[model samples]
Target: MRSTPPPPQLQVVAVVGPTAAGKSDLGVELARRLGGEVVNADSMQLYRGMDIGTAKLAEDERGGVPHHLLDVWDVRETASVAEYQRAARVEIDRLLAAGRLPVLVGGSGLYVRAAVDRMEFPGTDPEVRAALEEELARGGSGPLHERLAAADPAAAAAILPSNGRRIVRALEVIAITGKPFTAQLPGSDEEQSVYRTLQIGVDVARPELDARITTRVDRMWEAGLPDEVRRLEQAGLREGRTASRALGYQQLLAAFSGAYDEETAREETVRTTRRFARRQDTWFRRDGRVHWLSGAAADRAQLPERAWELVRDALGR
Candidate 1:
């Protein structure tokens, strides 16, 4: 009798959730079980020395599994979704060629979608980006939001006014490509995906996740997060840019300037993190492909077993 052949290669397994949801541990164990490599998908985790704030998995904590794309960029330099897609595709392909599964893990919904769905965000023109950046720097996000609202009301309705980065990027797309941002969203692309992907989402009740966010923020401060931010500030990396505007850094700035006390800063961090998590949930909920696993039973022992079952069932492995 002949032995059974293994299932065909799937696109990738994407483990996504809000902060403090144990995505990294799950990904590590899943990779160990399935002979997979972990790929970073979080926006903040790519920045060097942003460990505690971004909740990056330490090298030792990775359980000797090869992880890609984490801590590969300077915090001062920003990376776009298109860039992430390109890098992730190369990494994923390499993993497959090595006969290992690629496990993409992070809470950054846009980055995860870019890797899994393989979105084709329009190429950026420096002149167009410069123009939009100038307008945003001079006027602010309000004016840019107004412009986006006028041009693409649907996208404006979906995007928050406070998301200055996205608003400006959308306007840049319209200016550069002469096409609406909503229309450019990647639809079903059956041909491009290398493997049949299993998208796993870890979720908790809003209140519970918010509480976890609060606790985690307090813990970050206790772990010398302010010192980390001060180092970045002294390095001249703090300014009106993408990384500085991250929830952890923004709250710390307030504390450093006496606008808010340390405790208040921690509280604000929790609030902002909760809001960011909510936005992440909203962004990911639209994709019906994700299989949501509750954080209520988020245990080290159970998640791996369950996730393996889900992946095996999905891939017929």
Candidate 2:
């Protein structure tokens, strides 16, 4: 058992990294040492009944820490970052007021930033949004992406062409604000956070992380991810605006539609997840505030201590 007492001024700690990089376990350990509770920042983990695919820690795996902002959305609901920001801040504030540290955990870069950084969402214009959404529905994302590329090449480069939702929103912002979406976004270091934060990033080498992801996907299959998906399907997962499009679930649904076999779907899930992890790594690496610690097996024993050192440094201990 960990015997070191909790720190006096443990305010906020963000455990961030790519999938299968050991962020969750490390966050639990950090929360234990900091007298903290966890508030999730994973966008996918917000959906109910998404446990196995999201690698959401079961109750027994959390090491008794109280967690918030998970399983708050039904499968059919569309995800909203603004709504998530509000909900997460409420819990963080409650935890602070109650004298418990707030451990913000996950690899969703934008969601994490929305919770901690002073980011403001611009107002939406209904006419502009409706027109843009109608265009997206008609011509697919390719034409719209070309337009975005012409208008704001940076945002187009950042967002995927197949991501019609974000592309539409980006165009909507351009039409409404008459400015590039990225122009209004905060730089890595320009914005101030709502609370004092010590963000610790857990990472391993590419090969090591790839191996971990493969092993995790294998384990999820063995743990009946198909069964979980089936249950969610009964609960309208296919109709979900966001949940149906998640990593593993999307691949599995393709299999269900006879697009591929389950084995092929699983294999593709591993490959797609590896690519997603690379993107996640790039996102966290761009941030200057995070104190990164290796999650290699050799370093696993010292991860908690290394994170504690960062916390102490942040506290000027």
Candidate 3:
């Protein structure tokens, strides 16, 4: 008798969308239904002690589904997309080898792409990076962002204006390769993917999304986001280049520094997050591979089932 061989390669499912678009809840629902696990792609959620502001789901909310790569980084460490890519691939591959489906979920567009897409990271020149850092330090992200927009409009549009670290990295890549940062990512050829993937984009109307973002900000403030930031501040959250600039955390840190009041910070969080969500949508929209679903538009209940159909069909393919 012949020995049994391993199963064929598994197709991964990615639930992606803007902030507060019900991606997490849907991801949990899908994972529970499909006997799969959740792999986080949210950049801000990677930091420890960032639950309230990042809106990280509580243990009870996980519905018994295992979530990987949540709270894996210290508050003092700058979040690295490259590092996250490596870790996420490892986790996704492990799940695949275990004969389980990997449900990739989050709003971080670049991190999501880095995990599933075949992209080459250009080498960084220390001097070039240091020079860009100096510029970012001296003038802030506005000037750098303008330059990036001139050099690579797509990259500038995708990255938030306040994300100095990512801006620097993009500029460094541009300087090193003398090419647009977006050029590093190849087209959506089937062979470019690490695995067969079903990219689902949760779509919501603008007015509803804006309202949801406002409500979320209010909830975060009510949940003692200030106190959480205070604790993380003591742990050097402000010192971390990446963590300090997270949406809610950035506003609160400014308030802490006497730049504004806590109320103003909360208001800014809502405003900026809505704008950031638009950028997130724009980023995912540029990826034609995403299958847009309106199940998140108005609390629609058919999202999970409809998504399952797509997943099921993709698996068969």
Candidate 1 lDDT by residue in tens digits, 278-307: 877877787777888876544545777778
The ten-residue window of minimal lDDT in model 1 covers: 186-195
Question: TM-score of predicted model 1?
Answer: 0.89
Judging by lDDT against the true structure, name the best candidate.
3
Candidate 3 achieves a global lDDT of 0.90
Local accuracy of candidate 3 as per-residue lDDT tens digits, 5-53: 8555446899999999999999999899889999999998999999999
Count of steric clashes across candidates, in order: 4, 0, 0
Q: Model 3 Cα displacement at 70 (Å)?
A: 0.6
Pairs in clash, predicted candidate 1: 10-195, 10-196, 11-195, 11-196
Per-residue error (Å), model 2, residue 59? 0.4
Candidate 2 lDDT tens digits, 270-298: 99899889988988888898888999988
Write down the RMSD of all candidates, one decimal each: 3.2, 4.8, 1.9
Candidate 3 TM-score over all chains jointly: 0.95
| CA lDDT, candidate 1, residue 136 | 83
Best by TM-score: 3
**Between the candidate structures 2 and 3, which one is better when assessed by lDDT?**
3
